[model samples]
Target chain A: MEPQLNLVRLKTMYEKMVLIRKFEERIIELVQEQGRIPGMQILANGQEAVAVGIIESLNAEDVIVSNHRSHGHLLAKGADPKYLMAEIMGKSGGVNKGKSGTLHLAVPEVNALMTSTVVGAGPPLAAGAAFAQQYRDEPNITVVFFGDGAAAEGSVHEAMNLAALWKLPLLFVCENNCWAGAQSYSQHCSIGNIAQRGIAYDMPGEYVDGNDVEKVYDLAVSMTDYCRKGKGPALIEAKTYRMRGHGENDHQHYVDKEELVFWTKKCPIGNLKEKMLKEGLITEDELQVVETVSKAIVDEAVAFADESPFPYAEEALDDVWVK
Target chain B: MAQLSFGQAVNNALDLAMSMDESIFLAGEGIGVSIHYDPNMPSHGLLEKYGPKRVKDTPVSEAAIAGLAVGASCMGLRPVVEIMFLPFITLATDMLVNHAGKLRYLSGGKSTFPLTVRVKAGVNFAAGCQHSHNLEAWLAHSPGLKVVFPSTPEDAKGLLLSAIFDPNPVIVIEEMGLYWGKGEVPEGDYRVPIGKARIAMPGKDCTLVCYGGATVTALEAAAILSKENIFLEIIDLRSLVPLDRDCLLNSVKKTGRLVVLHDATKFGGFGAEIAAIVAEDAFKFLKAPIKRVAAPDIPVPFSPTQEKFYKPSARMVVDAVKSITG
Candidate 1:
């Protein structure tokens, strides 16, 4: 059944998905043109719903700890596109002062922290942030975004156990895009459903249609509300499909071509636009407006990144040690 | 003055800190339980008195425990995390190195992590390789962390209190072997600053420098040598990082001979760092080359017979001191 979502919320969700798509496309284009970014990881394919659904329901004070595939998460959480692009370009005006490249972009103003390219590293950090929130008696929830592959990691289970046992206000969003690099979910994880692992910790867990943006948003909103009300931790497994390869260089030879074609048909953005049109929630003209605005924003970000000066050589040593 | 066990002294330090500042809380595995390892555990009665909110019991996730402590400390709370065993601390090094140690520096000094990580080190009761490890050298090599290994009950109370109040990440290595060992501890409210070494014994012929359980062994060796007319000086390095170079150099200059002792593997151990400092600063004052008495570069054997040979003993310290002063 279709989840009840307001027109305004649906549009906002569409805008966020479009922004993520365009932002990732722009990043891929830039990387193809440029030889390398010292420390960058692109999460371009299958994780838009997790980022949009959770960020839309969070307050400005709420903190997010994202995995390597965190561009969509950061952008949706209000990190400036210009600074984020500059950061990927290794410019001085970038977030983290260019010290943390793309993989480790930390925008404290937006309460977003991205970790290194190590999988399953953000849950512990999210638990820490949640602990901090509870200690300070702040009405904020800490959301951690991880991939399906991270479900197999011992650290993830450990963090889940701690969050549940301590009753910390933590929301764990698993972007189950069905692949961990070249390996499929079946090869990596024994449990068919990753969210079911939450039961071991005695926390609330749910599975959502990741392609359905409204369903994802509704679940995330409800789960976040449950956590914010001091009901402890919850986990959401957004079962989605990656329309493209894992990264820029991967051809995804391991994935069946027919399966790829099937997921492409269920592209999250296309499905959302179709739903909006069928419900008469948004006109074609409104969709066009969002596309134009998102494209313009991506173009401006590219220009800003290209024109921005590279970080000073001395800045390399500056952020190495905080005073 | 109240004389407390080493474990009780550490517990008292936490109680004092929590009483003085409401922002301080203790969190770790089995912390809320009154009878975790022993019937009369040091953390016993704390959960009932302070409530579970302050004395939290976490799952057996060292990484999460360390990360939570780091994050909580960054948000203006002093968190003391206890890892049941020192070997388990390796799981938390990522958070310790990436977040706790580098957060303040990464944020351009906008953040400060006042975290105290407590772990018990040493081979006692045959806990085997996984539990018995003297890994302070690994933490000492890191720039942003403060490493403290207190030997006596007083130093344990003082150093732990100071670590809680200090505006940095401190790793307090409590030797499990010395937990039951007693010493004089001041009654109420005392703190010993980090980076200070104390002269446990004063003599002229040779200087023996050590900390943690090795201090007791060194003192025993010093007493044995004194009966034979060999006056030995013993300096206990209460804190490893920001080491007491002045005390070490002064003692080395006066004694003209030195013997460094530590329970960790001899190669690349913290004692080697002390040897280097003396060699660089007081090389000319030395009448004999500095000697070191430490465990060989191997894991602590499980067998009692082998473990005794693996750990540096009072006889080894005495032998090293006699050889250096001869």
Candidate 2:
């Protein structure tokens, strides 16, 4: 059965995802040409649904903490593409004023906390935000996005235990793209499923088809609602696959060609487009308009980044601490 | 005036701050419980009397505890985080160093993290190396963080209340040895401002600088030295980061000698920083090269004999004073 989602909101979510895909592709091209981008880690291929689905379900007041692969997360959370692009370019006009680079973009207006380059650092920070929200008696929830590989980190385990025990309003979204850098999930994780870790903490856990955008959005919305209602923390492990290398320079030597092909067949964007067309939720012309608009927005953001000035030399000491 | 323990002084300061300013609250692991201290005990009972919302208990995640305190402080909450032990601060260093310390300067002065992290230093009984290390020197190196180590109950109450109200991240290092040590605390609320060192005792032979539990040791050593007609000037360095350079320099100039004491390891301790500051600023007045009497570069041992050797005592301070004043 189809879940009831508002058509306008669904289209907005689709647009956001497409824009993130285009923006990341542009970033990858620039990185390949220049051999450097301020924030090097890019989650271009594997984890769009995890960011788009969860962020789309959040209110502007709710906060988010993103991991190293945070471009899609930041973009989906409604950061200005121009500033984000400028940030990746290390320009003064960027969010974080270029001090954070790509790895640590933070926009306070949207309530997005600073991202961490460490794999499992965001969970504890998110738990802290949850504590703050609970303390203030605000109906805000903290959503943290991590990778399947980060599930092995002691910090993540500690964060989960704390979130559950304190009944903190937090959501742990694991984007299980089946690899951490070059190492496959089987080599790194003893347990086959990352979602099972949630049971140990006594928090509700679920696995979703990450490529199915509608399913991811539905689950995220429900989970966010549950967390807001003070039911405590929950875990949603989105089973996805990386279509690109671990980063811009990676050749993915350990990944099999067949496995790569298998994931490409399950492309999240492609599946969403097909679903929209079959269900008559949107016409081809309307979808074409979204693609065109997203491309233009991405193109404008890239131009803005290229044209933007590098941060002033004195800015290096700025934004390291709040005055 | 009323007699109060170091822990009681801290609790009184927190209660005074919380009552004075509605924004101030306590958050930490086991803060609300009587397990570590006592629920009816000064600080723990304040939470119960105030409410769970004001005196909150957090899960055993120091990073989250510290990070949340930093975030909340940025948003106008004066959060006093009770880190059970000084060694456990390593878990919260990222937030303390990167976020709390740098947040004010990073935002180009747009934000201030008014957070007070209360932790106990010194080896009380046999808690072993991991739990007994005095690591204030590691934190004092960070320019943005304010380090406070109070010796007496009055100083603990005043300095902690001041730290709670200060507009920066302050590390209040309490000594487990002084937790039960009683002193005359002021009847009403008061605050000992950061960046000021107190002259615990006055003399002309040598200037003895110390903080936390070692301040007691230094004063005791000064008394011993007085019996020998060695006039020792004891300076309690209440604040370490914004160190009272003027007081140290003036005292060193008058006495013509200096001896620094701490419970931390000798190398790279806060004593080193103080010694360097004196050498750089007041080297001309030195009778002898400044001496730093501190723990050897070893962990606090569990054995009573070894632990006594690991921590600096009055004898060591007296010997150092004698060497510096020779």
What lDDT score goes with residue A131 in model 2? 78
In terms of lDDT, the poorest run of 10 residues in model 1 chain B is: B34-43
**Model 2 ranges with Cα > 4 A deviation:** A1-5, A278-280, A319-323, B36-42, B71-76, B102-112, B142-144, B187-189
DockQ-based class of model 1:
acceptable
* Candidate 2 residue-wise lDDT, B1-326, digit = tens: 88888778888888888889887888788788757665224475786678988888887888878877876775567889888889999998877877777655543354567889998787756999889888887898776888999998999999998898888889999887777777899966798989899999999999999988888888889889999899988999899978899999999999989999888888888888889988998999988988989889988889888987888889988887877565
lDDT measured at residue A116 in model 2 versus the true structure, 0 to 100: 68
lDDT of 2 at A149: 85
Candidate 1 lDDT for residue B258: 86
Candidate 2's TM-score reads 0.92
Looking at candidate 2 chain B, the ten consecutive residues that score lowest on lDDT are: B103-112
lDDT for A305 in candidate 2 is 77
DockQ each candidate and list the results. Answer: 0.34, 0.32
For candidate 2, what is the DockQ-based docking class? acceptable
lDDT per residue for candidate 1 within A258-301, as digits (tens), equals: 99888888888888888879988889999999999999998888
